[model samples]
Target: MSRAIRSAPSAAAPTFAALALAAGAVVAVLLGVYGSVHQPTGRTLTTLGFSSLISMKVWLAVVAGMLALAQAATAAWMYGLVGGSKSAPRFVGPLHRATGALAVLVTLPVAFSCLWSLGFQSYDTRVVVHSVVGCLLYGALVTKVLVLHGRPTPGWLLPAAGGAVLTALVLVVMTSAVWYLGTQGVPTSTGY
Candidate 1:
């Protein structure tokens, strides 16, 4: 029905944005940590900035970061829907949708790159955990309508907003942890 279609986009935006934000936060932080974590020599991170992009760690992080930014746009759109504002219509809506779609487009390359570079190892718990978390976040956004039990909130884009912001926060902390550990010259445990 037209009713269902009308509400779908609005609700979906928040969920997508939240997932992106969370993933982005994680990626950004992890990139930072990659440099901080030191080996016995503590010089392994000197080349982090440029090298990161080419590395498995950095690739995923970048994907997350890019997606996160896109998600922000999406959430903003959702917020407009909930808040009954047309502020997000100008460029936010299209930009959000494009970015979300683009994120998915990039997923294939990232996934392939990860599989090729990291091999079956990156398929370990730590990587899988992150993947599952990211997927859950995405799923939550995409399926929010079904879960809402009939479009409950008008200005309740909070769940989406909160999730996104939290994701960014978590990314900062997690990446910081990784960086701190690396800075300490701990061994790079890929299986984490």
Candidate 2:
């Protein structure tokens, strides 16, 4: 067990860590600013055969959010923060990385559609919350990825980043997807 753990590669180079941190911060800030200021066009692009694009986005976000939840759980297990397991199975690391990648992949289209079509809105309380949370969600993701790649990172940084990512995703789901479903009724086409 110890040998397996020891076999994992050491932290990344200091130069890489610095670059990741700076680049990640800049990207996050740009996203936040862009989301905040871009005027909503009040139009959306739909997936093929979907009655409404919003419904499709909702479902996609939910799936990504659920995957993110799995990533968080696996992370907790890896850190011995949950499941009472002293050592995480080898599969846990791969699962975490795979799920994380999938979550990000699924979210990309939704984010692009939102940013291109909606461009942030706040006509109502829910709209405001949703728009803000959406921006934060991407920001958190960038930070999490940067920290994950950074060498000599603090022990607490990874977990904290993961927690932030999970929180942001949950908030995005609640404010947008869940709220839309509760208020607008789930579409029969998607059966969600």
Candidate 3:
């Protein structure tokens, strides 16, 4: 490859990472806002005074749980960009960035809803775990943002971020599986 052409991938990298960080930031901020607002009092689900189609729990879960899932896909998409064990194609780079960014975008609503759900006084032990992990994951995402800002995007960072995100997802999904299965489960989130 010529020197001029070789520079293209590197130049393109910062843009991709910036997009990922921006999307992630939006997701995290929205979630943080929602987490701070949710305060369910009675077991009954209430309306948000919007269209008649939405319920509070449904809206919140969709936002929080879905955001978590979207972030997971973002991690994989990042890995796809990084293309460990194989050199990532030029086309794949954009795809990776796009997917990662999209995942974060899709997650924004869920994140806020999650935060909103926590506002409710009636809480479960599982929720506490979810909250802590959510914070840690968000913190990791912030680190990812800083990393992107400080350096050009590298292939390895994708997997690292993905691994962090996947770990969080594991905790979120299989909270009680461990004790039930006679093994230690992942720790719960504390809304950090």
Residue lDDT tens for model 3, 1-192: 111123333676767666666766665555555555655332323234423212332333344445555555444443443345334445544554565565455444434444543342226687667665665566556646555455456555555665666576456444423322345322232112
- Candidate 2 lDDT: 0.72
Model 2: how far is 191 from its true place, Å?
16
Clashes of each: 12, 1, 25
Candidate 3 has what TM-score? Answer: 0.46
Best by TM-score: 2
Better of 1 and 2 by lDDT: 2
Tell me how far candidate 3 lies from the true structure as C-alpha RMSD in angstroms. Answer: 9.3
The whole-model C-alpha lDDT of candidate 3 against the native structure comes to: 0.48
Ranking by TM-score: 2, 3, 1
By summed lDDT, the worst window of 10 consecutive residues in model 2 runs over 1-10
Q: What Cα-based lDDT does every candidate model obtain?
A: 0.44, 0.72, 0.48
Q: Find the candidate with the highest lDDT and give its number.
A: 2
**lDDT of model 1 at residue 64?**
53
Please give, for residues 25-62, the per-residue lDDT of candidate 1 as tens digits: 56534433432342222123222333432343444455
Candidate 2 deviates by what RMSD? 4.0
Clashes of 1: 12
